[model samples]
Target: MSTLIVPKLDEQPWPTLGPQIAAFIEERAIFGPGSLKGQPARLDADKKAALYRLYEVYPQGHPLQGRRRFKRGSISWRKGLAKTEFMAWVAFAELHPEGPVRCDGFDAHGRPVGRPVNDPYIPMLAVTAEQVEELAYGALSVMCAEGPDAEFFDVSLERIIRLDEYGRADGKAVPLSNNPGARDGARTTFQCFDEPHRLYLPRAKSAHETMVANLEKRVLEDPWGLYVGTAGELGQESIAEGIHEEALAIDRGEIDDPQLFHFHREAGGTYDMSQREQVIEAVREATGPVGEYGPGQFESIAKQWERPSADKAMLERLWLNRWVRSGQQAFDPNAWANNGLPGSIPDGALVTAGFDGARYRDSTAIVITEVSSGRQELWALWERPADVDEWELPLDELRESMAYLFEVMDVWRLYCDPFFLEETVAAWQGRWPKKVYEWRTNVASTVVHAVRAYREAIASGEVHWSQGDPQAADLARHIGAAGRRRTNFVDDDGQPMFMLQKIHPDRKFDAAMAGLLSWEARRDAISSGVTRSRSSKMLVF
Candidate 1:
């Protein structure tokens, strides 16, 4: 929460339509202008106008059907496909609609609260003319279909309001570091992460972190965090991949009670390569082979969008959004989604804690996994000094939290970042230290531990979550795409010391980092691990 600072409401401009679109949106969705008392359809004037314009402007061959998934390669037909524009517009409708939709709320401490505010609205975040309109319409349609009872709240205040040019409220982007009265006039709701794939890089990732953190803080716990985007790039890394992984999990049911919405052109069918030669030979005899085309051509055409042009394997893993396995990793989301949360932990088990620290203005997280019961609980409980205050606090507070966790919760051990608060930690140890064991992680060590812990938890059937908790689910998603650094550091004896490097340039799972530290600490703390049932209830302070 600290390193990932949420900009104030005034930081960005409100999502306002042009004069014509604005008029249309107001007329269709909200109440009609002037003497007109009532209107047809399920919408008010603003809803109607916005939805009408959106439906009217969608381009031919574009994917508009809210079926299982839209066909890909449709963008290729248009000269200048404006997906971003459409998405932006969709985001606007979701946030600014006259009625309500499902949304989350948060307290000043950033803890989630209340039943989700489910309103009948869909928001998009498009960036082009046609896209803006089409996306707007698609979102509105979804809203209308949901009817009056369906409503959701949002955490994104800025996206809800109208913005001027320069990505600012009044044409000037406010400096997040210096602006006051930022969130004065913004709206809030169940947050949507539109087009996550577009932000694959570090800068994009950071922006996403900022946005998501802001929303999380605002929406509180159990709010729906919807992510809509195509798969881009592969590798076990990237935020898009994370979304894809979660969708896969929801599809498979590894996470319980997950409401998954995904659409892909290539998911409906499959092809057999073994019959290719014979089919190709027949095709060759028929059409003279069309140069090098054969039975494989059919398969390729069918799967064109299933993978990307760069890094076929990676693309398959990422864009195709399929599970990419290298070894005997357990808990395939596809498989688990079908099975439900693994009965890994026995009921009434002993649990340990894992904590990850953050640098800059990031969150501090604590993850508890019941060793016997297999129940897993993760909380990004604490925020950084910068998140709440202008400057950073040196060390006293962190040490106090750490000590409290160690003593009160029977937290066997702690996994933590050495660099984030290295000096502060030193100060803590110097002033009033416990003989507590610790694992200081670097990027490389963090990755190893991450893979080990995740694989072990899933493979061992020891990881379970609270059903129907999007907050925990979102944390899981964030953990999925977290990558690690290449090299790590060592101590005086050349022993692996800490995970100092970053996973992605922009994105780092501070929560995951804390989890890693906790995992490592558990190993160091216990002699013979206690039975899972013996672990006490989750401790929260």
Candidate 2:
């Protein structure tokens, strides 16, 4: 099966304490809330191999000899692969009094030996309160309560506190709540974020960031993070996808590696979705031995995929562990992730611009794309504050940003939606009469045609985002929230035309619209032999 094992193995592998740690886990850990609710927990061969990789350390007497080589370890397996349960055991090793979770000294054969951390403070965090009872925390609860090592701790639904000779609390494992107060967990020795894809809520994301920063405080413990989950929906600006991108950057050598090891597995073999047997084989390949024992896991997934109402895209993403976005998302998350090049366009470089305007409830954006390199940058964006009803679109700032773009870059064309700003557009047109045009997004034919061209440009590597800009994350959110919206028009080949739409009514994709307009402007400029402008840079407004 095709797998993504980052930082490809060295000619000689590093020594690890994984075997002893694994033995401890199997002896003390019990199954979490699942089909094997109270059964002894076991790791399949594939998962055990991944565990060895996670624990691989530097050699015996180096400066950081016993410290873990990978401070952050991730396993991206298919659904039904027991990823949550597998990670829960790692948490157990961290929290248990007898667990050999930390490395102390090297063995006679040069293998790292392990020991328990003193006064461990481990938190198994779930994105929401409801998920705490179903995910990693839940599994941990079961293992501590029902396992052979029940005598080692005082287990309760609230928390698991390890006991010493006098029954005093030595270390503890708790399910952190998703509240503002619960996020200040600075005493953490090891933190686990369960199904971080669901961790997109503002408070949840904040909690994660806060917890990550806390990992530095307990340096002596050699603190680490363990993340395990199935593939998540590609967009939604998920925490999972963010880490995935970081691993990719490390793989590309664009950034210094922070000892992150990502084990990403997908069904490897080619298959026809139409063939039922082939579909089952792909599912089996992805799930490995985990699917073998699950109650009808492989057959059930295949049936779901064959259902008339099923989301084939989502099924492919979840069951096959592919990164392609599901739910008719307008842009490919992989494509967008791969296309962000690190640089900025020089001032006076020719570029095309697009504008999408909105009033109080929504957002406004102006995206610019360089004529020569096809790099798009989020020049400006404005959003209304949720608590403030007395807000405006800040047209003055919008106009100023546009003027800056014009003065800095030789804008060849400016395509703008005049909605809620017809007078402003008129004034700008009057100033740069030859360079600006009033492009109405309400026109189905023109808008759809332009949107298709923009999508094609993005997919074909003809357009990309600049990584140097901190505002790229904001633009990524706007782009990620966009799904498909069917238009009344069709393409020249007779396929139905589509425009970007919000996956939810409350979500904002205005930057995507602005990007589409900018790309459309670029398309027109490229066709008319007007890719660049040598005119003197000036903006009257």
Candidate 3:
């Protein structure tokens, strides 16, 4: 059997607390399923390293010693890696009275001894009742079934009860579903968020956001949480992906937040799925220690790969732990990343603005493109806040920003999509006359041409964006989330023209739409012989 070790970040040496937690897990917990079912839970090297890093703390005599360095930690590994089993072990340890205590100092053996927290409350959260039952409750129940730990902690179908000397429940592990009311007021010491990718749907997103916000309150308490799941789809906008992106930003020094820790292991992007050897290597790398934990794993993978109905994207996601985007992605993320320049659009440059608006749920975006160099700028985006239920875009603020842009730059044309903004468009058109034009996006043939032209421009590197601009990154995200769909209209040669559609309902594509409209306006201006010299001064309409 081949052994594959995935590379990870280098950090500080593990404190004695790491090995202590690992010891607790090994001594108390048992495997829930697979080839190792009913056996002692031994920590593999990778799992031990992860636990050590997660539990690492500042050395004694430091002001922040014993306090957790990371408030939240994520494990983004491939499927069939016993992620649930590991999480269940951590959950059991945290629920135990002696787990996650303050370290006084190192002993003669350099081991860190811990002081316990009084009455710790741990919640195992998932998006569905069945998931909560299977992943959290099922694993915990199986681990605590027949041992001395079983007598110490009574395992039930609904919850895990840590009993006192008199047999009364002292501490507990609560299994929570998606209901926000059930999760409202309980103070949680530790939380396990399982399969957060399922929470990306619009209806479930609100609950997930609320739950996370509530967990943030733990900063005043124990302030530790764990997120364990497989890699989510690229454009899914999942909470798991959001956490991973934030961790990446922190890792790159783009942002500063010491409370977040992220760990992800997957195959390289260049690995081709078509080659059998490459596929097997990637799968082995992703499914670390499967030979020991899960016998017949490679045989199962080979069988699945040979099956006629196997989905390549699904295999990439589940086995290789890669983020497989839709086949119809409008722009390759690599191309977009390569096209970013270092500066914003030049001040007072001749520019055309494209406006795409939504009333309540969807986002509104304004994209500006410099006519001389085809550099696109994400001017503004108005999105609803995660916490607010009845939020609406501030039209007055939008109008003020628009007015400022027109006052500062030499505006050549303003193309508005006029969706839920007909009156606003009319007012702007009345003010600027020739400068403001309503662009009909509902027209199939026009949109087809615009999308095709914009896609070609991106592929050809005609579009440039400011590097390190957060708004520009948001624009790229929206563009990446757009996928092509066949339109009713066809071209002259009877070839079907494609229009952009959102990969998921909650994901916004307004920026991509605005870019397309802005590109169309740029093309029109160029074709009409409208030069930058003609628009050297601010608009006087």
* Top model number, lDDT: 2
Rank by TM-score, highest first. Answer: 3, 2, 1
Worst lDDT run of 10 residues, candidate 3, spans 1-10
Candidate 2: C-alpha lDDT: 0.79
The residue-by-residue lDDT of candidate 3 on 256-311, one tens digit each, is: 54577677777654555567766777777776654434576655674566667888
Q: What's the residue-level lDDT of 3 in candidate 1? A: 11
Question: Model-by-model lDDT, in order?
Answer: 0.38, 0.79, 0.75
Clashes per prediction?
A: 119, 0, 0
The number of residue pairs in model 1 that clash at the backbone is: 119
Q: What are the per-residue Cα lDDT tens digits for candidate 2 across 1-541?
A: 3577787778999888789888988887888886788887788887788888888888977888988898888888887778888888998888888788788888788888889988998877787666876788888888888888888888877788988878899988888756546647467888888877667778777777788888888889988888877667655667777777666556656456567888888886777788888898988887765557657767777888778898897788788987656556787555676689888777888888988867666788888888778888889999764335666798788788888887787888898888888888898999898888988877776777777777777778778899987789778877876788787777778988886776654457888888888888877777777655554553322
Q: Which residues of candidate 2, in runs, are more than 4 Å off?
A: 183-185, 268-271, 289-291, 294-296, 327-447, 450-541
RMSDs, each prediction?
Answer: 17.4, 8.5, 6.4
Give the worst 10-residue stretch by lDDT in candidate 2.
532-541
Tell me the spans in candidate 1 whose CA falls farther than 4 Å from its real position. Answer: 1-230, 234-349, 383-408, 420-435, 443-456, 459-462, 466-471, 487-506, 524-529, 532-541
lDDT winner between 2 and 3, please give it.
2
Candidate 3 shows a clash count of 0
User: Pairing residues by index, what is the TM-score of model 1?
Assistant: 0.40
If scored against the real structure, what TM-score would every candidate get? 0.40, 0.67, 0.70
